[model samples]
Target: MTKTVEFYFDLGSPTTYLAHTQLAKICADTQSELIYIPMLLGGVFKATGNASPAVIPAKGRYMFQDLDRFAKRYGVQLRFNPHFPINTLILMRAATGIQLHQPQRFAEFVDCLFRALWVEGRNLNDPQTIAAVLTENGFDPEEVLALSNDESVKAKLKENTEAAIKRGVFGAPSMFIGDQLFFGQDRLDFVEEALRQD
Candidate 1:
């Protein structure tokens, strides 16, 4: 039987970006279904009393170097965005709207957005930049951006964040295989192992 993996992530997370790149291959190899669940990391942290590693002095100092090493190891491009840790409310709402209205397009938008943020150092929080990114990805920029401001979309994003907290998720790049919660990009190997279990 094929297992189902739930991936909860936020674009604001560089670690999540790294994990996202490898997750598809893991799922394909293991014949598990990958369910992408985007939620606001800030909200998750707030509800779960969790803090970002970057907020810790030592970890914050080490994160950039670690990301560099990890990026090189994964053979993925990683660029530091000048606007690191920008507000992701609009982006999260946009994602929720896309998922609600067009699931396939939502996936495409997420892929492009992640590449833009983590690879190209583009400012995803900028409206013009986001619109351009969407347009370049063959999406209707105006339509998608409009959804970013939709009340229902905003509500859904909030709901998703709450759901993550209720699921005991304290951070981004978390994955659930059955009742087991694997936190952080580094824990992905554990997730893969869980998928292999009988």
Candidate 2:
């Protein structure tokens, strides 16, 4: 039997970016399939009555410090974006569109956007900047912009967010191994253990 890990994420999240970088290897090592479910983190928070830790001054500071430690441990570099709180609506929509229509390019889209938002610290909120990034990544900015506006893609993103809330997802970087939900990049060890169990 093949195990599957459902990863619910948003590009706006640095922690989710960390999980994105790690989950593939974990799934490969465990002989599990990693499924990426793109859902708006803000939508998840609204549905779950939760707010980002960044809303809390002390927690926000501590979270960044802790994330730095994790990056070191994971051997991945993450420079917090100065332009955070980026409106990821279009970005997440682009992701949903890629996953739905261009499955093979799904990882590429994820990698590009994640690095743009988290690593390269690009100001993704600027339309021209986003378009340039997409074009530089070998994607047609206009085509993806069209897809982001597609009715099906918009609905799919909303549906995914609703389903995530129904499944008890309160935030991004939530992983489900079977019916067990693990929230946060910090809980990935538990996710790996869950995958190893079956």
Candidate 3:
């Protein structure tokens, strides 16, 4: 059977964006399948009582520096979003909805959002900016927003978040190969190692 890596992510996370950049290549190198799971980081934090490193003054400062190092090492563009702590409820819902309804465009949605917020450092917290970004990327912003309010889509996102919390997830960029959970974009080496194992 082909190995599958379940990536639990929220677009608000720079680390998740960094991880997203590398996961495809890792999966390809290992002949593994990459599954994107859109879960709300806020919900995970509330449930697990875990918070972002940005909440700490010192950690937040050093975290970005470290993330920059990783981005450089990965040869990917990663700019810190000035609009830190973007509420990703609507965005993750759009991701879940796209994964459920327009499966083909799911990756496209993920890519645009990640690049908009992380690579280009757009302020996605604003509705107008979000619409403009979506439009620029050829996505109908109103349509995508409508999908966010879909009952089924909302329920699926909640379910994914609940399932992640139950599996000991406390933050974004959490990856699971079989039952082994690897948290943090920094842990991709372990994830890759797991993929190569039984």
Candidate 4:
């Protein structure tokens, strides 16, 4: 049986976006299943008493530069958003909705929003901006917004965050090969190695 790689991520995290670009191919090559788990980064931080590396000025600058280097190494486009800290509650809720409802289109929605928030540097904080992005991508903006507000979707997202904290997750781009938890996009090599093991 193929091993499963559970990817716990939040859209507000650029590293999570970077990991997403590579994990699919990694799973394909390794005969593993990639499962996407959506959670709120802020909630995780609050639950674990962990803060973003970006909270420090020098570290934040260097982190972005490192992210760009990784993007180059991965041969993927990644432009840093000027709007640094985007509140992704609605976006994440929408992701949970897609995962629960339109499973077929989950990947597409993730790619679109990742590009919009990171590559294209769109201001997704604005509802109108989100609507435009959704409309431009041929998705019904109103429908998606409504779905994002669903009670079940909200609770699922909450559960994801709580479960991640319980699993010792303090940041985005966390991947699990069985119960081995790897944090950060840079740790993907170790994750691959874990998958190769019996």
lDDT of 3: 0.95
lDDT of each: 0.87, 0.93, 0.95, 0.94
- Candidate 1, residue 50: lDDT: 87
Per residue, candidate 4 scores C-alpha lDDT tens digits across 1-198 of 789999999999999999999999889888999999999999999888888889999999999999999999999999988987999999999999989999999999999999999899999999999999999988899999988999999999999999999999999989998888999999989988888888
Write down the lDDT that model 1 would get.
0.87
Off by over 4 Å in 4: none
lDDT, ranked from best to worst: 3, 4, 2, 1
Scored by lDDT, the top model is 3
Q: Model 2, range 95-147, lDDT digits (tens) per residue? A: 99999999999999899999988899999999999999999999999989999
Model 1 ranges off by over 4 Å: none
TM-score of 1: 0.94
**What is residue 119's positional error in candidate 3, in angstroms?**
1.2
Question: Against the hidden reference, what TM-scores do the models get?
Answer: 0.94, 0.99, 0.99, 0.98
lDDT of 1 by residue, 90-163 (tens): 88888888899899777788899899999899987788998888888898888987998899888888888888
